[model samples]
Target: MSSHPILHANKTSPFGDLTPDEFYQKHQVLHTHSFISTNNKIKLYTQTWRPIAQSQAHPPCGVVAMIHGYASESGWVFETTAVAIAKLGFLVCAIDLPGHGRSEGPRGHIPSVTPVIDNCIQFFDEVRASNRHLPAFLYGESLGGAIAMFICLRQTGKWHGLVMNGAMCGVSRNFKPVWPLEKFLPAAAMLAPNWRVVVSGNLVDRSYKEKWKRELVRRCPRTKRVFEHPPASTALELLRVCEEVGRRCREVDLPLLVLHGEDDVVCDVESAELVYELAASTDKTLKVVPGMGHQLIGEGKEILEEGFEVIFSWLKGKIKK
Candidate 1:
């Protein structure tokens, strides 16, 4: 497998000391960014990474549409996985949902899931259209995992497989708002939909196991000092989405690879188990790695490599000529 790109990342930059152009050259992949306007006039940012050779006559082995977690964009640390997959001869694309990254919307305010889902479908469909013959897969992390499941449920057999890492099948009880605060979410959401009031867990400390990695994620050039806490409306919608996913995951019949950290506190591991059990996908596989946190990529070097190795191997086995 191509070395996990995270291996090159430092606390200062995802590219270590290399400039963005040098970083792409180091990995031998071509990367590009663009923006698309949604029907509501929201400008969603999108990125694509492909092996340089594929830019010529050679076609890619397959296509991978990726979705990043809430508060997370498609670039910076998130695109390392894209580069890793691209180096192994597949095309990978990711989109920054509205309210995050360069997209236009209130930061961390997801008033409704419908528009977010629609935006994803709009972007992913275009990338998948490039080479209809090549097998395609959906890859999402954290909240993105839930959205990916919804996409698969809606599109049914449009995708060949799905891979979710640290997926928020359900929010960890330890992470959600404490008692009375949860009870008032409906009223709070209705009255002040944009209020950044739903607060409890510390994602940086809870998500990344390594200290340096936590610092790296916190300093994300895209987010910089932006407040990442979801507003009342988004918080309420996320809870609803989790319940809806658990209630309807049985309809998800595509091949699946569910990877979650055994010790993840931000997203429940048991919910992942529940998903693995109830999913209609006959080819589903569940792996709960011990001693890891919400971000599998931030696990110590050895663990990160092994975890990603499983993903790469799975993708290669499923690819069509």
Candidate 2:
């Protein structure tokens, strides 16, 4: 636990107090939504925000496509960052993964990550097509970070850079399911893929340095508490994803910014370091903050502001905005 604690205001959005358009007007941004059809025919929820024309006389600086972590959705805390980026004269878009948030699918269950990545690629491809004249970037947190990296690898030269926040490059030893459960994952998954295992209660506790932030995350209606643990199938798939990513770290040639908490117990900092060390990209940076946990957004205001400052500065430098 971090001793340097700070209380944060309950995160609130204008969506409740005003209409969608009214909220965007008040914020000086343009907000739009689309129900994108994925390869699996899943009607995924997608949204984008761009600065109002008056906010930036120059054409938008760039376009950023965001992917949220497992059990998380783009419609909640993640939207805060999207809005901030849009207000900074960048067009930002995000999609809710099939099984999460407003997207259509089963709750808290992902049998495989392929379809999810496919969904993001489809939506992000559409966004990229519309903004072909602008530089493009990918931003992801936790599992989404790995997905973003895979996407970049699959489509070289497509992105100007990648921003990974506490990405799940590798699972931490502290959070791995117990001995028998971990060892039996493959067989168990085959037998009962959808079965929810009794693991990872500690993730939420270790993720947010602040208790209130953890509580606030738990209160999110769109993300249920059941998401705390990966379903048997998802768990097995995650291990494979990490293994494949670790093996192919040298193939990551895109400009990258990988941020992780030195003390993060969910996604090991060592994994981030490993990626940093082996990545073929010439323009790559790794920032490991001591005592910080998994959720940078849940950090103290001072730390949170500094983290975003680092991220935005890096993005601006890479995109040349």
Candidate 3:
């Protein structure tokens, strides 16, 4: 019921032209809400769900930070996942990254990875300052996962554990390689950064396919927004971050739970394997859910539930010991 301030200008595209009402109706099924962070210059829009039984008395379980993917806001993509994690007895803080969601920044422009990591650290500090007793964990999806890993490597002991779903360690198929191209492309594009490139070839999951079908019939234009198309220089910066993080995976020493779909087209499954193989943490696990696509958490209720159980069991075992 709380209002989330609209910050960025509504973009115009074949997929980005939906009226506010249509967008809200498409996502009305989930209990979506927002809050502003006092510590940062940006207005942080977050979605939170507590267990029904413990909504009044905050649960004793650890706090879990849910980081969302590129071009997508936390509200639109992470409602179901946040509810699932909260149902497992944890307080969840699912925030829109600086440029996404309702946060303050130019739409889709991530100047560098360091600033993103800094913002994440600030967000975590704000959360801890608000609620001190709950141990915090990192739950990142795709680009958010990559940001979480970077944070884990840079700041030690901040997180009790890490859960990454479809994390992007390196570029997937159809993305340009990061050798000589990486050295100059991002810098050059920044000067003339408004160029838009269509990123195609992403495979659709069944659930998303159905949702897209429904939205199409309803003429819901917002649901058609592409997260990565019209690639800006900032998008290239993200790719560079992925390349750097992929090399630094061995530096992660905390408990890690990595989930990826075998059929993911946005991120290569081998990237997950690489992280599992290189992470310094002995308490690491990788789960490959079958028939799922890039959006593993939103693919289906069954898959989402199963993934949550896996994460819950792991966290419970660790917390118990």
Per-residue lDDT, model 1, residue 136, is 88
**What is the per-residue lDDT of model 2 for residues 191-297, given as tens digits with 9 covering 90 to 100?**
99988876755567777787667777777788858688778998998889899889988999988999988888888899999999999999899999776778787
Question: What lDDT would candidate 3 get against the real structure?
Answer: 0.64
Q: What's the candidate order when arranged by decreasing lDDT?
A: 1, 2, 3
Report every candidate's CA lDDT.
0.87, 0.82, 0.64
Output the lDDT of residue 215, model 1: 88
Top lDDT model:
1
Ranking by TM-score: 1, 2, 3
Query: Which parts of model 2 are misplaced by more than 4 Å?
Result: 1-23, 54-57
Regions of candidate 1 where Cα sits further than 4 Å from its true position: 55-57, 225-227
What is the lDDT for 185 in model 3?
A: 62
Report the lDDT tens digits of candidate 3 across residue range 1-321.
Answer: 111112111223112355444443333322446666545466766665555455346554777887877745566435445654565676677777776767777666666767777777776777677778777788888788899888887779878899888888766765543356546666657676766544444323322433542233223232234444534576677677778877899989999999887777777788888988999998899998887666654445566456556767786776676
Clashing pairs in 2: none
Q: What TM-scores do the predictions have? A: 0.96, 0.92, 0.77
| CA lDDT for candidate 1 | 0.87
Range of the 10 consecutive residues with the lowest summed lDDT in candidate 3 = 1-10
The weakest ten consecutive residues by lDDT in model 2 span 1-10
lDDT of 1 by residue, 117-180 (tens): 8999998898888778788899999999999999998898899999998998999988898789
Q: Cα RMSDs of all predictions?
A: 1.4, 3.6, 7.0
Model 1, C-alpha of 241: deviation from truth (Å):
0.9
